[model samples]
Target: MANKSVFATMAGKLLPRTDTRNHEGAQAYSLSPRQALAQLAATGTFNATFYAGAREQLTEVLELAWQVEPEFLAKTAVFAFERGYMKDMPALLLAVLSCLHGDEFGRAFPRIVRNGRMLRNFVQVMRSGATGRKSLGTRPKRFVQAWLEQASDVEIMRAAVGNEPSLADVIKMVHPKPTSAARAALYGYLIGKPHDVLALPELVKAFEAFKRDPSLPVPAVPFQMLTALPLTREHWVAIAETAGWQMLRQNLNSFARNGVFEVEGFAERLARRLRNPDEIRRARVFPYQLMVAFTTADAAVPKVVKEALQDAMDVALANVPAIDGRIVVCPDVSGSMSSPVTGHRQSATSKVRCIDVAALVAAAFLRANRTARVLPFEQAVVEIDLNPRDAVMTNAARLAAIGGGGTNCSAPLERLAQEQAKVDLVVFVSDNQSWVDATAHAHQGTATMQAWNKVKLSNPQAKLVCIDIQPTTTTQAKGQADILNVGGFSDQVFEVIATMARAETGADHWVEQIEAITV
Candidate 1:
């Protein structure tokens, strides 16, 4: 007679965001995540065709998750399986089920056992769902049993894994970064990294840096940064001895269980003095502290390209004046950057649009007094600052010298993280064509969501801007530009980057950033 339903207790408990668009999502090939889920539920009621590509499915899944509940996920988990939503999920969900209840917990994560009790909550989500009128998949059942009985290292790896290392340790890995300075301070304890972000780039750099030079630069940046306010030395970042950012950090346990990565090293925290980040005050430091640092090293790229990069910087500086704004931009001759900058598909010949734009933006930041570091990635980063003069041949030589081949997607983003507090934002303009994921059987990387997820985890405080100018040229035009994969792919890129940027700064900052790029 009443609504004593399992859905009621945990309707919106796990994930809180909800996608409300219902009509437009169906009319178009794409649906906002929430509509997809709603459609999935509605689709299950009737017989319907859902997309099959893993990347597309993943986008739909994350968008749904961003807005739906575990109850909704559970329903889709059950219903979508029947509808051929994506044939590969049962195995993944089984691993999740096992990881939540498996004994592998104490062994792989000994320190976590004391507080990782959150792992148990996952089972309630699995068992309470409607597996009604259906037989449990065997591999999934067996996996769950194996997990409940004896969770082994091999068992965990079988679930999902890869080697991912990071360069720094202090930055938080949470998404939707809060704007409050007080929250930022309290977040140090709560906003700490999950086992994954540590395995990203910053951890690698920080460790290698320590090995080479044990002394960490005290203030992070080269010189100084203006104090926002209430960021006094006496302030403590650790608040709510229990109720802090760890509220979610504790959930990172789920990551080890379901995500495709590992944390197989001495688990440790980066020790540093933290102040109340929630507050900012004027005159936190002298006016001179705002100046940014810039430099480019490595002689592999064409020297003229470096010159051109500098010339662009000069032009950008001439346009704006900001004290601490700086950029260290390097043009690449290493191979990947020289492909072509034209925004067309068939024109695979050489061109100079991205390099030119990269140089212009890099120089503009530096001229504004912000530090900019630019390099092109192939086997590794070729840090040759493209030297630009008024001469066209010089520009062409630099552009022609630079080459674009191979894939180096993560390197630049990691580079930005290495700069730490020194950089306030990162604007990466590139063509979204990675040999690694773009050619995968089914755009599997997009489905995994790790690469996208990693960006949110590692650079918890920096603004990341991706302007896709994927160009094409047959021969007539030097290069043409088309912004593709703003969401990573066309749809996902728009959703993912915008979400991460807003999370890094505030919604307001994200607005200003878009205006800067478009205006």
Candidate 2:
């Protein structure tokens, strides 16, 4: 017989070496520069996470931006905004692009900075000198000028709500040559400069008129523009009637506090609208966002409204694809996962935590694939039964309320191997900072890779995916033909996971998707 202990299999020798340490100081493999950029673009909010601060994230992103091709950076900005539904990182990437003279930056600018908040973020980042330039420069100035010239009156009006390098500030710095008298007046109005009031656009005129006379019908403006006025029940009712899906969802408590729900039939009507399938689809609503609204709603909010958010979650999770084979999803419920999903900002920290997103992913998988198993893990596999028939939000809440010990990324996989479990796909949703499993004797590769190697012995065709919910440059499992390391909390991730599980892709599937992006 061959010396089985002394002579390892070819696969054993082929296991990639651990090259770096995770935030927890665990053995991990560093991602390639391009891979790191994509991951950061999808997950970095420039806010402080449990491990990295806002400044550190900003510095790392800039470092990676300099390492990749300018074209990749441009495509990434578009991808982050359009698919990932991210705000800050996309704007930052666009700001970085603006410093270069290439057409990629110019092409990506209009697409990424599509609205007021984005425009403000772009200008703020540029002026802060974070992207190697403090000024918009000649070409970027042209883009800014074009944006001001081309935007419609209403579009520009809606853009007037946010500040801190406000649209007004951007206008002053860029000095956009307004193409029409209305636009010129609008610019002056935004910047508080004297202008002919008669030249104001109809929407602006309507807003001004409504401001002057409370009895006048409420103008269809941003919710922020209406808050200062002494609004009556009728005004609040009118605001609810015209508010968009997102605005209504976020301000449910505010509406309740202002007695909008007290109006007979208004609460029921708003509830119906909240759960409307068309509106849910049209809003591109994330299931977790609905979860946030459901969780954060105050006691004053109506019962029907909360239930409607639950229904909206069902409609929002339509993107969770059904996989064809046995699946096991392990959601990390460890201590570090308690940090906010978008990280911690002083006043703007997200209520949704990394654990909530992980649980949501696992619950979504179980809902889509009824037979799929869920193993919520912390220091080890914390066994918990989840019903597929239950609502995604319910199952997610149950899983999210589990253990908060050290992270052991290999625990669930180790359990599967121990039981000789057969799985076609194994998904691990985590922060990818597993320190409990990094033993002194196991220096060749991560404990996750070791456990995965064992699982692969029995099921050679199985695939593994690590869905990272935080911005980090390392992973427990290195990318390979059967392993995928992707990040993001958006439903866009579901499509890639489904494609990979169906064997429609090879290694670098995530990178391939980003590379295939057109400018």
Candidate 3:
């Protein structure tokens, strides 16, 4: 009851708009808008308490974010949109554009509007505002035009005459002048809708220009148009040669859905692309991409295809810095972590759970540092043998096997203390739902804090790093000079670790330093 009350109290604090100041119950300073958005996107579940605070001060946060760190805000919005967190999306988008002055919105708008999912949501959100007698501010107009220019015919047609007549009026309000071959192709499609005379000529010119310069970037409009047109095998081959691995990866699902290969020898070519070590090293693949691939790969994908993907991931993993300290990773495998990750769409029978993220983080540390040990815990601690060369998912499965009956967050530290182990860093990957038995130590402090104090006493130099994989409640380990609390699964998490390892002042100092670097 106390634990539940603690969570309720934390949520209660966030309900008030004026109480934005950082406090023990509400660590507002630590919860940046970007970080909060990341947590929401990853978990697919919004904490009403947390989000209520965000919604109340949404414009203020956007204003501050734009003034201090526009790039972070822009990037976070794109990521949040892609991750399907859309509750405050209409306001969030408007706020982002309002805060950015001059051509800032113009430059950032393209990236946000290019996604089909984003475009669909934009139309819906904008239509809802129109229906509710809310104003569609002038700032989103530029983005709407940009989206119209780049959108496929299917999307344009859907927006133009589909259910919402206001959307058609909005689309007709802004006319995009096509400057690029791709945009020209999209323009041609738009004009051709009503049998405009310039349509054929525009399409021909765009195709000819693209055929002459295969190296030029193909925007979505032209790509979709070309797919519909009768293009020769040679043209598709040229497009394939010019398209980068990132593009190929992005379109893989589309290809699977359409049962069409944009390029010949799709599987073999992608496999070869993944095998290139330099390409893998240079690719901007994030940890979440790997997670998605592991979970969503079709059963028909060949063994070699899966192996190639794994090889690419391995190359990326090589970049993780090897820290110079003995690190013990304690991943909480309690029943709480069995819940499905927030936004991941999986079947009812799927076994993939939130704890997989904890395992992956532990594996990442193990792979990065030879001195790292994995101590998975539920009600108690258990050691799992891990090798740097082991596949990450394999390590996750191994860790998940030692499932715990209850959450005892302090068990890892207690085990280390019992063994008199001198660890430099103790990383707890958990939901931070640490609760003592109702009958035991009800009036005392948390078992995690008490165990952490004992560990600190034994090894004064040891620091506790709590990685909140499923942060649903207030963390048991308070943010302090020696304690670092990070949420979500990102490569940035490792960057923080590397920075902490090198810093002489301790966790808080480097935490500030990292925040500066990000900002």
Candidate 4:
């Protein structure tokens, strides 16, 4: 009976010793080059996080991209853009490929740089000289030219929204040979050069006519193009009626401010549009995005519209699997989790933080599986009763309110061990900067690993999923058959969690998922 804890053997493979320090200076395991690249591709926005700066993130991603094979880099770019729905990191990877691997860059270009914003991001990042070369390089220039040439006139007009490297700037740099008189005219118009106005596309003509005479019917152009123009509430009402799902969700406040909501029957129409399952599915709305809309809506925004956002949350959470057996979700509500989820960027910082995302994940699970247990952890487990029937936004708000403490990733698992609880799956949504439970010695894996070992003693089949909401190359728990380390705030993570919880993925699950991408 002497020191059973010291002498006991675990049923699982021995955890790897902590090999590196995380951004929080806690002992952690360094991810492999491929794993690190994929993790960063999924979560890194190259903005300042609580622990790392934008430059540091950019350096790390470039370093990791260099370490991995060109194929893996291509696959990761495809995975990040298509599955993770990430913007900047995927473009960065593709930019890196442009210099070193032309063929892989070509394969990934059309996929990652799929839209206008992404196209601008590619040009901007490539020109930043952060990816080792400043110029677009010959092949990448050809790809850009082809993209400009193939996109429809409306697509090009929509692409004209953002700047830094505007679509016009790209057209100037690439000088894509116009295929038709209309194409040449459109290019000249975007770049502010004189061209035959008669050759312009009909939509462009309509937009120009509407701009000149406000009495005409409002053209269906991007809202940015119309914002500066003097328009009546009637025009805004028309824009609100026709705005796409994402556009509408993002502009509720603008609609309210413009008195578009004052029109009779329009509010009800909008509420229905927001709650439509088909619209939500087609838009690929993330649950947190709905949370943003719900929280950011002004008082003038109609009540029905807010309620419809909640309904949209339920639809977005459709992928959150109702896994069988006991489950525990641990969301780190530490002080650092308060950093902007997308990292901090001046004038562009997200009101949503890492804690909010963790809470959203936990609440979504409880919504999907009524029996699921949620333990919000800071230095230790914060006890709170949550009604599964409550709206996902409500539960998420409650969890996020309990915040500003040290992170101890092991606390919930240790509590589960203390209670001798039998769990089928344990999900940890956090920044993974667990230092409160750090051990003094380097030989030990981590406090989280040690606690997970104890938990596994009673339930060997139990799975663990660590969803890192911030970008980092290390984890408190090393990934194995029973453990998965995935990153990103996109709802796609829920699908990965569901698949992993069912034991459907092999070792290096995250990397394997990236490899499966057909780039």
Candidate 5:
């Protein structure tokens, strides 16, 4: 009865949404309360409570998920209750606790473990009495993990991030001068995720703590910016730079047939014995250069409205200190990354739209160097040294390499890691699935594959950033998403890059103040 009331309370808070009317007794049903409420909702008893006896039984809501392995799912609960479920509860716990096999869940859990009291109890229980214990944390209940696992990545991220800690909240919690556990819990919470909403107040406290005392491992540079691709609209949807797709001054067939998209050797000829001015003029006429030039003009916008972007560019530039603080992005030529990344996917339209994001990030990097490289990567990395003097041959190699295959993150990560001079950061754009092994089959449900799989870190010290493009939720209307074969690319890339980026930009570093600039 009490649990039912609790559920009712939660429901009331959750209900009365902007849209649809609230479900009368729905929220209360979540609780495994006493028999009365169910009986009432059902057959209208307890007051003849029969939520189960109702026209539509109270248990109907659980039917869909339980339908997974109908006989097993349906019968198992009863068997567990009547027979020996709690005896095997740990195993069942693992079964239900899906995060052990989840991607972002596993990644965030250990950190959450340190913060949550219930999780701490669960972990302790697992250590003493469980057969299976996962590395991220403990498996106390199958349902707990499974329920958490069923939730998506962003959902988990939001949940893991608690209410943004504010100064007032801390003041309100009157500690009996504070216990050690409470203090550590509070301190860890503050440092766990700086700049995050729930954790921001804690972060601010930590910063004040650090400023007062200089030696407390002044937090590392947070490299989150480089890890996120700037070229794509999704990365920083506010950046108004028009990335791909020319407005059709000329027809595609006509342009391709004539010398439009052609890669001429004007730069080569200019370097050779040729009278290069005209050759440079011809190079200037090439599409890529025209596009790059277009992108830069947009990058120079003033801060106010585009403050975050300008700050990103400023931080990226300041950290790397580019020759002119600009990057020339010749993204992967493993395939037709030569096409504008934000355009249509009709082979011609969507050719390299994905690469556009990479280019933008790289451009930000180059703006630091005053110039950057836009190369192709497939079996190997080919420097796409585009000539500012001559533009025609620029897209030549990229055009030829348009049909790229086999992308190796190891190759790039290795190269970036090996570089003698430390650049501020690195960002790569590709459909990440390319890095996955075809043999990497899913051994269990989506859950199992995520938990146990771990790729060896190639660039141990370097921040290896990757933005794998997946078919957008609206892909059917937009067209086939990029066909890159890297399975678990997004998960893998985000995991590695976020950690590294966080390290690069110290926790003390202000996000907006870090030396990055974005237009």
Candidate 6:
């Protein structure tokens, strides 16, 4: 495991190299937009350089979408846009709009443009396209029609058209006649006119017909239209019943506000969905969701709802593979990590911080590995006891107790070496901004490298995994053979670990293993 160049290989493939330039015979690579977004999302700090770099990268990615993997490009663009951290909305908007009109935009645009503000941008960008040199193409037209069919807001659609005489021709060319009641409503809504009252029965009938076909996509159109209907409690119940439990879980707040929680059998239905393994895995329920539920759920809600959330967390983590040997989970609870995970504005109201994310990652490992030890670190380290059965949020709270100091990345390895602890793996969950003790000259290299080498003497097969939560200008610790660098929290980390455990050779093979599970 210690004989491969995993970090360099993975970094080369995943990190953008466009930033690299010849600097006096040496290559200097600035952080890519993807990396910048990761840093911003992790630390929630305002960095002008990273912001400008990210804006440039976004434009580059959008223009080159035809040359890149659509899924990867879409994920990068959508994640950055949705994080709402960037101060420059217009640049982000243009980048998002370009991606939407790019090849294979269908895979992501629908999911991203659902936000009202983003949808407005879609209209504005389309208007710009109509008047500008670029023509308003079929793809954008199709997206607008589809979005209108799902969510028919007369004002928004009119705003999209905006008396652009050229747009009327495009709308007519794309949608000449209404094929269904939803389309009829959309056409009527867009033209600033109302459809016949008789269309209501047909819409309901169409919705009911679609509800019976499991092969069909979820009835997003009918669900959205329901908000405007003057329906009885039974009608709302029927709509909820038709949408199924998965949709209901994602919109718990809406259901609660609509008094759907008071509906009989609602709690039982939710509980059953939470316990379903397939649903849990598909939803990818994480600690963030649990924290949100804890912070946002009303006091009047039933206890069963809380229990269901806990059950969902358990089901989500049920499949994590346990480590085979002694493992140490080191979570960096430094002041830097206490910054909000998204943006400064969000920090004022958000309970999630980078430290919380690190703690959650540590808790995940502790829950999976029976013999694992957890050390929360900043300038120093403190041992904390944890039970596998403890809830993830509980573990995070305990880990968050140790905070407010500079990050000394070498402390954990140095401490383990001094104590003669025979550890097989050391997982450090941090942003990797380790400058506190990094300047010290040591036998191997940096302080972290020297300490890691000393620990390796006692445990030659020990592997180091740095779960980098942010982007850094500093280079990471190098290893002879057994070191891995991963960003963010996902199942991808475990896949890399499993590959290394099999003693996989060659950087290409490792890259393939990681990329296979990327999406």
Backbone atom clashes (below 3 Å) for every candidate: 89, 0, 1, 0, 84, 3
Candidate 2 local lDDT, 1-519, one digit each (tens): 888654556453356778888888888999988899889888888888989989998998999998889998988889889888888899888888877767988889888878878888888888888977888898878888888788888778788888888788899999999878988889999999999799999899999999999899899888799999999978989998999999999999889988999999988999999999999888988878988999999999999999999888878877789988899999999999999998887796789999999999999999999999998899988978889999888899999898489999999999999998999999999999999999443355888998999889889899998999899989999998899998887887888898889888765765677788998
User: Model 5 misses residue 314 by how many Å?
Assistant: 14
Worst 10 residues of 5 by lDDT: 473-482
The ten-residue window of minimal lDDT in model 4 covers 4-13
Tens-digit per-residue lDDT, 1-519, candidate 6: 565533333211122222232111112223334443333322222221211233343344334433445454555444434432222232233334454445535655665666435555555445554224244466666776666456544333333432333334445545645667765755554455676545544434454455565343333343664465555455555666666445655566766767777888876776676567787666555555566665566765567887787777666656555768888889999877885553244224455667877887788777777678988888888767788778776887788767788877888988998998998888888767665664422222455666777788788888887776543332245423576555545444555555555556322222233234322
Residues 1-519, model 3: lDDT tens digits: 557744443211122121122212322223444444444333333222211233333334433444445555555555444433333442345345544565545554555555444554555545554223344456666667767766655465444332333344554555566656554544555444443334434435455566567555443332544565545545555555555665554555544444434344776776788667776545566554665565576765555556777777676566567877788889888876775544223233324456777877788778778678889998787756777677776776687666657777788987887887888888888766654321132233445655677777668877887876643324565556677766556565676666665654443432233234321
Best by lDDT: 4
Model 1, 1-519: lDDT tens digits are 556542343211132121121121111113334333433332221111111233344344444444643433443443323322222242223223333343432222221111111122222223334222122234333433333234332222222211111101111111224344332332232234333323323323343354455344222211111122222221111111212222212222322232211222201110001111221011121011111101221243233323433343232233233423333333323243433332223323223334444443443334344344555554345555544323333333344455555544445544544443244344554433333322122112221122223343544443445443322100000010111112111111223333443453332222223223210
All candidates' TM-scores?
0.28, 0.96, 0.66, 0.96, 0.26, 0.65
- Which is better, 1 or 3, measured by TM-score? 3
Question: What's the distance in Å from true for residue 86, model 4?
Answer: 1.2
Model 3 local distance difference test score: 0.56
lDDT values for all models: 0.30, 0.88, 0.56, 0.90, 0.29, 0.56
Residue 268, candidate 5: C-alpha displacement in angstroms? 33
Name the candidate, 3 or 5, with the larger lDDT value: 3
Backbone clashes (count) for model 2: 0
Error of 2 at 393 (Å): 1.6
Error of 3 at 352 (Å): 5.5
